[model samples]
Target: MPCIRDLRIPVSTILGQLATGRAAGEILEDFPDLEPDDILAALEYAAAAVQERELPLAAR
Candidate 1:
């Protein structure tokens, strides 16, 4: 299984898709190794960022 933390692309991108309406199960259809916990982590990270309104230089 691949590590969600190790995905080369930004987790935020996936998180946004999820937030909009995509399902965790659907995402794993493409990436077989992804887990519910990985989805949860992305959600948590996105929520924290949105709540704090913190925009890092890399994101902007």
Candidate 2:
């Protein structure tokens, strides 16, 4: 799997894909070796990462 080829690509990229409207089915189709759970975990990680950033609305 391409994912296995590079373990350091943070999960944020995956979350970005979803946020930009890439569905799970499409992601899976594009990267066949990724399981459904991997996508879910990436989402969870992204959520946590955002919380950690904790930027105020004023910053945006």
Candidate 3:
């Protein structure tokens, strides 16, 4: 799993927060050590992770 600047904060953790309707500012407030770019990077990393890949689909 990818982490934020070796801080041991997994990208999934950030994504989970975002998925729960938390704003970036709110996340930063909760984790004062995190920077805006870290959140952006986590999003970017997730986006890239799912790109150019194919998944199996069941036939109807």
Candidate 4:
């Protein structure tokens, strides 16, 4: 499945930078190809992935 815009970078890589205390501006600066929305999308995608639940878990 598609994870990031244009696949220039993986969402996990973005999350890794974020986890290492990289600011949004820093990320943008480091990855000139990435837009602000790409970062936002990565966060949103991560949140959605974490929020998803299996059928049995949801039923419980």
Candidate 5:
């Protein structure tokens, strides 16, 4: 599978950090190998993937 920006860091790892309410700065600070743009790219990749899925809507 393709990793993030040619690094071994997977996008899932970045997403997990965001999911746990970790701030972008915190993630970057904790993971010196990552960049601010890496977080943004991971989010964008996740958003695109979600858009391709079929989600159930609430009852109107």
Candidate 6:
């Protein structure tokens, strides 16, 4: 799993906080070691991860 530059803070952790309506500032407050750009990078990573790709599915 991707982490914040050796901080051991998984990108998923940041994403989960954002998913629960926590703003970037709030997250930063909670993790004083994190920077605003870290949150942005996590979002970007997620966006890239979900880019168009094929997935197997059962026929209907």
Q: Which of the numbered candidates is closest to the native, going by highest TM-score?
A: 6
lDDT of 5 at 57: 96
Model 1, runs deviating above 4 Å: 1-4, 53-60
Q: Model 6 off-target regions past 4 Å?
A: 54-60
Error of 2 at 47 (Å): 1.3
Every candidate's lDDT: 0.70, 0.70, 0.95, 0.88, 0.88, 0.96
Can you write out model 4's per-residue Cα lDDT over 1-60, one digit (the tens) per residue?
Answer: 435787658899999999999999999998898989999999999898899676754553
Model 6 clashing residue pairs (backbone): none
| TM-score, prediction 3 | 0.84
What total of clashing residue pairs does each candidate reach? 0, 0, 0, 0, 0, 0
lDDT of 1 at 7: 71
Residue 8 local lDDT, model 3: 90
Q: Write the per-residue lDDT of candidate 2 for residues 16-52, one digit (tens) a residue.
A: 7788999999987877777788888887665765685
What does candidate 1's lDDT look like per residue over 9-56, in tens digits? Answer: 468667666778988788878677677788888777767767956566
State in Å the error of residue 3, model 2.
7.2
What does candidate 5's lDDT look like per residue over 1-60, in tens digits? 546897888889989989999999999998898889999999999898878667799998
Question: How does model 2 fare in lDDT?
Answer: 0.70
RMSD of 2: 6.7
Which tens-of-lDDT digit does each residue in 1-60 have in candidate 6? 899888999999999999999999999999999999999999999999989999899899
Clashes of 6: 0
Question: Over 4 Å off in model 4, which ranges?
Answer: 52-54, 57-60
Give the RMSD in angstroms, all C-alphas superposed, for model 3.
4.3
